[model samples]
Target: MQGHTPTPVFSVRDKRNLLFIILGLVPAAALAFWLHILPVFQGLYLSLFRWSGLSPKRKFVGLANFRALANDSLVWKALGHDVYMVVFRLTAVIVLALLFAGILHFSSRRKQKIVQGLFFFPNVLSVAVVGIIFTFIYNPSIGALNAILTNLGLENLTQAWLGNPKTAFPAVLFPTVWGAVGYQMLLLFAGMSSIPKAYTEVALLEGATRIQEFFQVTLPLLRNVVKTCVSLVVINTLNRTFIFIRVMTKGGPNDATEVLGNYMFYQGFENFKFGYATSIAVINFTLALVLTFVVTRLLKKENLEYA
Candidate 1:
């Protein structure tokens, strides 16, 4: 009988606390929706119409813009450039970063910190700044690269790096790798540091050489970290538009180095075709998302038990 007393449902204090929590979050939620979500929706809507962005008129064309993009040769070419970026820039960044991280990880503590700091310095600068610096470095007449080649008697190798279509994409790719390597190095270094010293020590005791230990122990354990780094690099390489377009070549020499980002920018801003640009943006976003998901899933299958 005493246990039969019913507990009160819906306590007044609990309800008041819930109400206060909702009220407190309302402003932040509103701001996010207005600034981010609303704009995304607006962009999607705009993609369904034909608009010049500045004109006073907009004509609804349904999926025609997307269809047009599918047939646009330039879009495919830009996408190919994006693929090249992933292959060259992203791959170089990951390789150099991991190599540097490995070297720093095996060094003394003091040396490790110094090397880490030096490697990560490039990441501190804005992308635009990095582009500008590299632009000067690749300048045909006075750039450091050309200057070095000239001094080394490799004059035949020296040309207007950014001006020639043959070298323009690779020229931009080098700077992208230089700017990005530092950040990825730091991430890999942190991951490597988290690995227990006992594993390597045991490997050494078993008469395993340092190279053998790296492949047998360190790399296997760092698989997850490698996956994360790869995903990030891919996304960055795909989404990056401004730095390449702004610094070296703006899809110059007959759209040779044009990537999706630059293509979208040209369509929307330069050509004033808002609808077409929105379609490109949507496609680019979709590509990035798909690549991220696919790579993450593939890596997850080979995930190592770091713990």
Candidate 2:
């Protein structure tokens, strides 16, 4: 008799487990596509029309909104403010966070936890709350900052922090840096902690000073984390809203503090120019995408392993 053909082994349990995971993920994937991705595409489509947000009629404008944005001086000004935020506010936050992370990495575990919590405390509060708090802190007449300045005999240096055009942008940016530095610090600290202790110990044995070890070894290994922190801060600064501008200035003192996000809001909700607002949204999204891609690509080219 011919040898019986061997039956292939099939594991029902493995098949069932795989099917269950796929089934569980389907709803989440669908929800994400519907809620986040669809609105972006819809905004892109709507940007080619001229329609107030509540208008029943929509005229096919064919890039008129984009053309208008190109010619609008206010748009340029708002873009400048956004760039300032990235350059000034975001840079300060990242640098401060890195410094704090380095200090914490060298501390005892208990002290490290306490310091980390203190740094991150601001991030736990809602943006609105932080905005309100800072608003009071910067109040021209009664704010804590000005009060302290007056008591310290620096009355000449004190001015309407959030009301004056000269100080408004920096005043608004201060709280943003305060609120975000902790999150970035934690990320950097985690990255620094993961570096092999043997490397540092060897360097110390060779009589390398703390500053020398930091510059030669710690900074290089922390490069990937630094890149990530910079990217996060840049994106956050670009998209910041509902905090500094909302509570402290409201893009006031003649729009001195207006960033792209607030500009888009004013166009859509305040001005009722839905199509134009959508166009602005598209531009902001495009800018963010381009910046993120360029930064990530440059980091990768430098052989910084983010993971």
Q: Against the hidden reference, what TM-scores do the models get?
A: 0.90, 0.89
lDDT per residue, candidate 2, 241-299, as tens digits? 53468666878888888877888888998999999998888887777777777766766
- Compared to the true structure, candidate 2 yields what TM-score? 0.89
Task: Return the clash pairs for model 2, or none.
Answer: none
> What lDDT does candidate 2 reach at residue 199?
82
Q: Which is the leading candidate under TM-score?
A: 1
- Ten contiguous residues minimizing lDDT sum, candidate 1: 3-12
Candidate 2 stretches with Cα past 4 Å from truth are 1-26, 241-243, 293-301, 304-307
Top-lDDT candidate index: 1
RMSD of 1: 4.2
lDDT of 1 at 36: 79
Clashing pairs in 1: none
Off by over 4 Å in 1: 1-23
